[model samples]
Target: MQSRTGARWEEFLGRLDRRLVSLGLVLFTLPPLVGKWVLPLTASSPSRALQAAVEAIPPEKLVFISSDWDAGTQAESRPQLTAIVRHLLKQKRKFVLFSVNSPTGPQIAQTTVEKAIKEEDLTEEQWKYGRDWANLGYKVANTPWIRTLSRSIQEAMKEDWQNTPISELEILKGVDRWGPDGQVAMLIDVTGSATIEYWYAYLTPTKVKLGLACTGVMAPEQYPYLDSGQLSGMLTGMKGAAEYFELIGAPSPELRVTMAGQSFAHLYIVLLILLGNVPIFLGWWQRRQR
Candidate 1:
């Protein structure tokens, strides 16, 4: 009778342990996906600053987006791009996209924009491709291309990515080489490369406001630019993506639930670790008493 009772207790505890870990992980991850409201995390300063800057822009002004990221860093870049695009479309801001790296950069940018538009339920009129935005596509090779663009956008980009004349694009009609009136409203760089440094050296000097979104590993490296005021705002990674989602008050099902689950899971793990350690400590205390 005593052995049976012990076995039952052990089985119960083992089952409970597994359930607690599973429940904790679910609780930690689920809110970011299904929750009606999430108290926004205050730790993501860069995303907050970026969203504030985007909100401050006039609805009519055109924003320039340089998406130099590809499949290699899609996990970070995709969400950042989605958040930015959603915000821009919501605010009715016009934008132009170009890439300094990989030939496939334009495709990735296009897909991201399209996905955001669909997800946000924005209309063609709200975020049209040719009129509200233009794609200069992959123009030149890396840093030199950025320098050329800084010197003369028109001369540097004689034709649109699709071989259309830049002059023919309604979005680019106001942009010129000389003054602020024709200048880009804001410049966004989403890249894994050092292309951002080139932008700071050449483009930011022109007084073009800049924002950045890079991978998780690159966040530390990007702080110098933010500190110097070269980058007006930034989004570091998926966490930054979630922060932006919070700011926009438009969390996707997956993100909200996942974040909640992650939080709960962390809590559960900490509890288990503490419980496990306490038993070991108690055992040591009892042995010492003997």
Candidate 2:
């Protein structure tokens, strides 16, 4: 009788409604995403290192931002780019922006930068283009261009994204190269593609500090670089952005809500997996006794 009852219970458990499971997930996940609650998170070591690296850049040197991501990865990359940009602007760090992997990258980065500037409440006088920053836009030469960029900034390109002569930009006044002795303080590549390879192949051994902001899928591949000291630090996807926000003493509400939703959803899924296996385990135990 005990065995028969166990078999019947197992059959009933196997027939549990999929719709109910889906509904339960919705119940567990939706509230957090829609709510204003932001769970506190500790900043990871990589995040701290990235922030420290940026801070370590000398005041007079320019930070090179190679934004190589487009809308396809915006949900993750946008926040990463924005957080770094906000940090740079807030610290009054002069920088330059450009894209080589994606034609749309520069435009998207520009939008993110503008958003950051507005959020930081910076004035035109405080953060003017051609002085505080410059947009070199997108270039297509890839390896060759980067090789040229390594040797001479003046020879690599002559115009900004707006077609304005690079010579007219006060930001590039004395900037002529990128190396240990160059005017570039550090090169930060914010990308979702494999473009970092170009930097590694052509630019890594130059003694310039390098950083990366990449998607979650790309994060694992970059760990070796971090471990080997080829990279100064990294910000991986949305979670990385959130960690950065924490390090900067500014938590993003949107990230807080999104993270809470993901956390709850993950927990719910794990619980369901454990519960789903219980009936099978009990059935096996009953059969063993028989």
* Top-scoring candidate (TM-score): 2
User: Runs in model 2 with CA error above 4 Å?
Assistant: 1-28, 268-290
| Candidate 2 lDDT score at position 267 | 98
lDDT of predicted model 2: 0.86
lDDT tens readout by residue for model 2, 124-192: 677998999988999884677789887788888689998999999999887887766988878899998
lDDT tens digits, residue span 1-290, model 1 = 22444455456556676766666666665665465444446537788889988887767667888898899988668888888888887787888889987689998898888888888787767767778888888966656766788877887887777889998998887576522555566888888776787788887767778899887778899898888887889987767777787788876555544445555656767876775555455556656777
> Where does candidate 2 have its weakest 10-residue lDDT segment?
1-10
TM-score of 1: 0.73
Error of 2 at 187 (Å): 0.9
What is the Cα-based lDDT of residue 93 in candidate 2?
Answer: 94
The alpha-carbon lDDT assigned to residue 238 of candidate 1 equals 68
Which candidate number has the best lDDT? 2
